[model samples]
Target: MKQLPLVYHKKILVLGLAKSGTAAAEILHELGAFVTVNDSKPFEQNENAQYLLSKGMTVICGSHPENLLDEGFSLIVKNPGIPYKNPVIAEAIKRGIPVWTEVELAYRISDAPMIGITGSNGKTTTTTLIFEMLEVGRKQPLIAGNIGTAASAVASKATEENTIVTELSSFQLMGTVELKPKVAVLMNLYEAHLDYHTDFKEYTDAKFNVTKKQDASDWFIYNGEQKNVTDYASKSKARKVPFYVSGKMKEGISADDLYVYWNGEKLFERSIIALRGKHNLENVLAATAAALIFDCSIENIKEVLSTFHGVKHRTQFVREWKNRKFYNDSKATNALATKSALEGFSEQVILIAGGVDRGHSFDELIPHLQNVKALIHYGETTKRLQEFGEKQSIPSVVSVNTLKEAIEEAVKISKEGDIVLLSPACASWDQYESFEIRGDEFIEQVLDLNE
Candidate 1:
């Protein structure tokens, strides 16, 4: 179905009432929709709610937006924080009212071609790298979606020739049906966000939705080694392209001698990839695959390989003391991700692991304990991880409360060649505003040894 430009007179239900919620309500209300905002947080303390109310939006605090399903709205603009099976969403679907994320709503109005990147491990790194590749031309791309800014903010000003590189989260994927990407890449998927999703299968279904709506006209790139992505593409009709870091793909991108391939074609070969870790290699492969699909010059991808600095949080090299490195991958907020983070090291490593438990199993990361010199446990996630470590007879030290204490314990136990790795296999919400905040704090504590 061709998407219509949203008309304003329709009644709209904007749910979640967070950062995205406020942006959605303001845009809709200005466009003439009778907007009602709903959030779990009390409207009195929410700054956005107070501001939106002052601007004449009908704010409904601490209530479900599902109550308004009978009001006959044209569409529901859902916040990505709300799960797809979220009670309000199911009710809206039952009522036959179209539901969209700010992304879907933005896509309908955007005249530009969007390039979307998704996966459990490397969305931000790939999205940021894509943006850097585009800067090869004089064109400055709109880097939005699940990254820098909401899609609505970009859509408000997009033109046909403008290019957008969007990072898509699974929650954002759930609300979008036909939001096709010119090039969509899924790096790899692991069990993440099970708490929000109720189960692993449901969470994966949402992540896969990023490519579910694609046709022959859209390009889909996925990890060749990821059995889940490669295996599922055989069962689906979407146009499939595989990328690999260890083994080479027959027709798509692969790494051999620090070079990348395209469909039966060698596009760019480089020895200048400076990012540490195999996961980052996979990330670069995804970025290069999409760039090649877009007909980005081999020279451009080559240039980006060296010039494109990595993102702030993930596996960032914070400091080196006595030639021993300190790596902060605070974004490793799930068991699978932390496992990937640890595998980057071959030598004895002191790992600061654990955070708020998110209903994922600790057994998944147990294999990585072999490389761990010592485990400096922190946050509420420690008890479970310690239990698993003890059962395996892996060496560990227990410390809770703050990252400072965790790092201090790790440093005390570190040998000259041992790496200090802060790769928590859990969320940072228990201690910091975000993974970014947590990473920055880890860097601060690491740098303080010079004091």
Candidate 2:
């Protein structure tokens, strides 16, 4: 399916006119697919759908009309964020029309082989690291997928010389049926997105789909530290390559605190990795494993590992204010991620957390709060988290109504040598539209302190 201008003249329905959906619609139309775009937002309000309407393409805005599904469409390209429980999607499945995310369509048309990375956490860091390593090796890697850009956007211009290094989410991978990469990395898995997935097993299976369609020639790089990750990788037909933080691996990547050993030879000092947090070491190992499978030079891996600090919103260092260091980890939308953020800081921290409750307990976050000097809670989970912090004997646990208030309170309580960390352990739906927006607000507030 590497044929140029694929999906030509085939009737297709594009659901959800967000980034991925809009990009998919434009490219599908460009590829000559008889495209009809749909989104839940009204045409007047949805700039994306409105833009598509002006492109001489058929668009149904305001709602996903059921009648549009029966327009002799051969395929349905859906937005990854749109849940499987969506009525139109469920109906499309019932009618035996194939459903795919833009990633699948992009995969079918991409001229370059792909290196797909997916896990519960650290995917962005690992994917960015691999992209840098590939770039150093002159692989002409195009980064896409769940990170930001749609895969098809990169695929539309790719050639056989390029390699697409994509960050796949369970949301993206679950819809993929034929997407296969030359190198697939499963960093690790944790219970996440239970709000979207039906259950833990379903989420696990969705992430494991990265290697489901690979053949023996392809490589499956997995976290040797996680039995679950290894267990799922075992089901893949691809050759298994395990990366670990403990013990030596004769064929894959392994690391201790000090050094990273790749295939029994010392690769680089783990300390050279600019990214903090022990969990990030696992990401380093995963990226190193994938780079090695892609045949990247060892020097390139070392160089990238030494220089790449981290991705934005994942332990991103904002700015030091009044001798106190501040970190923005607004991407920490779950207990595990917040725990990882706290693990990165050795200094006593003024922690700001809370948001929409995902019906999970804050018990998983208690152990990581030993270094927290103060806790500022806000949004829906404020009371519960403040209570939890009080019960845990935290020195200061204050509840606020908004994130801005939480940030201001954190600034007042923090002192020199203390770190201000915004590691919200819940979703951002209560106040902001996305984690990126929440993180931006945190940064904006922190930047405002200079005045």
Candidate 3:
């Protein structure tokens, strides 16, 4: 491997000085580009800006004004969180300065071919699955994107032979028009991030962008289970390869409990292990599709996936307290996910639920709550779900302001074989740092009982 000369020359404006944004700023600065770090957070609040200023780079805090756009700049590297809704970005577009996401900047820097994976759900599971599959097949891949590491961060350390298995969010893909991956997996598109996009169509369009730049030489693998994804993918110009868990894939892969059959041929399958439900099955299939496209041995993929227990936050089984089993699905941040998590618990469940609602209608999960023994509510949307529970006499309890209180109340009412589940179908911003933090705290509280 050779250290290539930095290609960026002109001044670059890096916006939204968050983790990904600041990383982009430093990377661009390292490339010898005159970097101007911009963010909406005030100077006192933005530790990144102060840190950059200490490092001798020009920093702009509080807002991205029109004057900054008017300033001669070669490129605008916008953070994933900064959407089209931002007035400053709107002004930038009006000024005709090219606006790019941190991910696009990441792709531009990397010489390695990529494995771009995006969907409404199952992204983290599938992303790690692909990375593991490639690893088992002897490819040292850089697993990155919204799974935590910025794409730019991944690119900073990438090599030619090393592949990138990216778990890209719609926000990351919104500005990506030319990121061509060798194998692109559009896992499954559904009603998500309606709070961010103008409509479902806009959101779906953003997820679909992963395949928009792919050529005929590249392959587009997707779940045929999602009608919207299947329909739009059929109309897409990319070389389509659709996979499914329920039925056969005309050009891609199909799955049974034993093996993932490709075009009616035996590709790969593993012995059934302790994977919980249907959602996980779907995740394995999506990963297998990408692995097959990348030339991974079918047997190696199945062997790894079979051994892979589950991700940290997605339906992670904590421990049994007093013969009562607890399932932590703090990653269930939408209505669809909550519905899926509740599918396995056929008996009465003491559900510890609610958080800041991510524009989800409770109606989608209402039918699935038939067996819920008690509904313990907390966070911003607690009352909304509690009121719904009252209409059906589901024995709802409201906690004063935190998830801990909700769990304490649910535990009191819970019986043996009665699942006490923390599948908050909303974001944790109102209560904790993120869903992962919320999940960790939930596990901590459960474990604290022993102490």
Tell me, by lDDT, which candidate is best.
2
TM-score of each: 0.86, 0.90, 0.87
Global Cα RMSD, each model: 3.4, 2.6, 3.2
Lowest-sum lDDT 10-residue window in model 3: 1-10
Question: lDDT per residue, candidate 2, 1-451, as tens digits?
Answer: 3543546888889988778898889888888888898888888888998788889889888877768777988888999999999999988899899999989988888989999999988899999999999999898999999888989888889999999999999999999988899999998888878999999999999998899999999999888778888788778999888887776667788877677887888877777787778788888888888888778988888899888877888898888888998888999988888888888788999999999987877788778878888999999898789789999999999999988898889888988899999999898999999999999998899989953
Clashing pairs in 3: none
- The lDDT values for all models are 0.78, 0.87, 0.81
lDDT of 3: 0.81
Q: On a 0 to 1 TM-score scale, where does candidate 3 land against the true structure?
A: 0.87
Selected candidate, larger TM-score, 1 vs 2: 2
Evaluate model 1: give its TM-score: 0.86
Candidate 2 worst ten-residue window by lDDT? 1-10
Clashing pairs in 2: none
User: What's the ranking of the predictions by TM-score, best on top?
Assistant: 2, 3, 1
Best by TM-score: 2
Error of 3 at 369 (Å): 3.5
Question: Each candidate: how many clashes?
Answer: 0, 0, 0
